[model samples]
Target: MPSYDSWPSPTWKKIIEEQLEQVEQMPRADFDIMLKKQLPMAVYNKELMTGDTLDAYLEPHAGSLGKASFFSHQVAHYNAKYTESYGTDLPKLKVPVQILWGEEDEWQPLMYAKRLVQDIPHACLHVIPKAGHFVMEDEPGQCSDYIDRFCNKHP
Candidate 1:
């Protein structure tokens, strides 16, 4: 991840905004194609998904124009809002927090996990090897085990 101050680079933000603008007008078939193209970046272990699993992942993304637009908006404004607030907000989190990050995440790099652990007082970071942005999808068993252990320790 880029520094919070420079997150969502101007070029990337422009591209996402343009995508959001066209999403409402896109046909469902075309949107599905776009999702298909994007799937690889989301997971590190491609072998984990069968055709049926791929279809299952794409299913909920149908009729998701609103969701896409909302996500785009967040990305567009992350530097403006989230960066300014997280400095103050993160340390306020009093409860134990587990940050399960994907070591191979393309969208958010491992450096972010370090930054987050530094920012939050009660947060511990776990980096799952061979996992991308979709950690649970790339390594479901490891992700679940981490979650279970976190819960057991915290509870």
Candidate 2:
């Protein structure tokens, strides 16, 4: 179970609320622009967060306001159960767990990775450098290598 002391920052809450409120009134292009501006926070490499990349990332999400609404609804209700815990269940996971985490993740702190490693009996963590929340985007080669190695080892 992930810690939720300050999981969703005020900025994320505000963004979700803004998306929910303005989805109908705002132009789709304008909403995309507004959302694209916030996308860089997920990536450590600012240079990789180009206009084309942002557009591509947003394309899949563009057709579904319902998806956005569902996420917003979840976020709205998250606070009510933030403190819920499943400490006893984590150790019961018998499968091998490989946690590929970003070293510079701004959203999820490194402590979560440490906590998970401690909780899961057959778990290992690999903190990829020069990566943020979107570790694969930030360091695709490293992410691919780690995932391939994990899969091969487990299989």
Candidate 3:
């Protein structure tokens, strides 16, 4: 998962600001109402923490951390090994897949959701409106309802 601060586009920042403002200005009840209006069938991740306070939490590690370099090297190493070792004969996966994507997600994009559904034999796709990469945070009720329906249908 990419850090919220790592978003490469200004539009994403604007969206984040709007979401933060929504969270800040509204009481819990009103926030719930707003979410329902935005996305009618999403699940909430109650553990999520947002707003400017999170920026303060991440501030200490913002500079010269070498974290980006480390991850790049790790990814390159895995890419080389995986290509040489498995090629096209990687083991087939049989897990049933349910992809719930936020239409407004700046990080992953909706195309990836479409690709997942296409590539997986038994995959279902649910797209939530007015939501970003953090689907639960952006449209909690919709996410939750989608998960419930997927589970019931599959089971």
Q: Quote each prediction's TM-score.
A: 0.76, 0.77, 0.47
lDDT of 1 at 21: 63
lDDT of 1 by residue, 1-155 (tens): 34455456554466566765675466777777766766767688876554987888776665666446545554445554566556667777899988888888777778878888998897999899989878998888998998899889988
- Candidate 1, residue 139: lDDT: 85
Q: 49-138 in candidate 2: lDDT tens per residue? A: 777888777776575574465355644564514543555578899999999888887777888888889988979999988898888889
Model 1 TM-score? 0.76
Q: Whole-model lDDT, candidate 3?
A: 0.52
Q: Relative to the true structure, how large is the alpha-carbon lDDT of every model?
A: 0.72, 0.72, 0.52
Top model number, TM-score: 2
Q: Tell me each candidate's RMSD, in Å, in order.
A: 3.6, 3.4, 12.2
Model 3 reaches what TM-score against the true structure?
0.47
Please give the RMSD of candidate 1 to the true structure.
Answer: 3.6
| lDDT-better candidate, 1 vs 3 | 1
Better of 2 and 3 by lDDT: 2
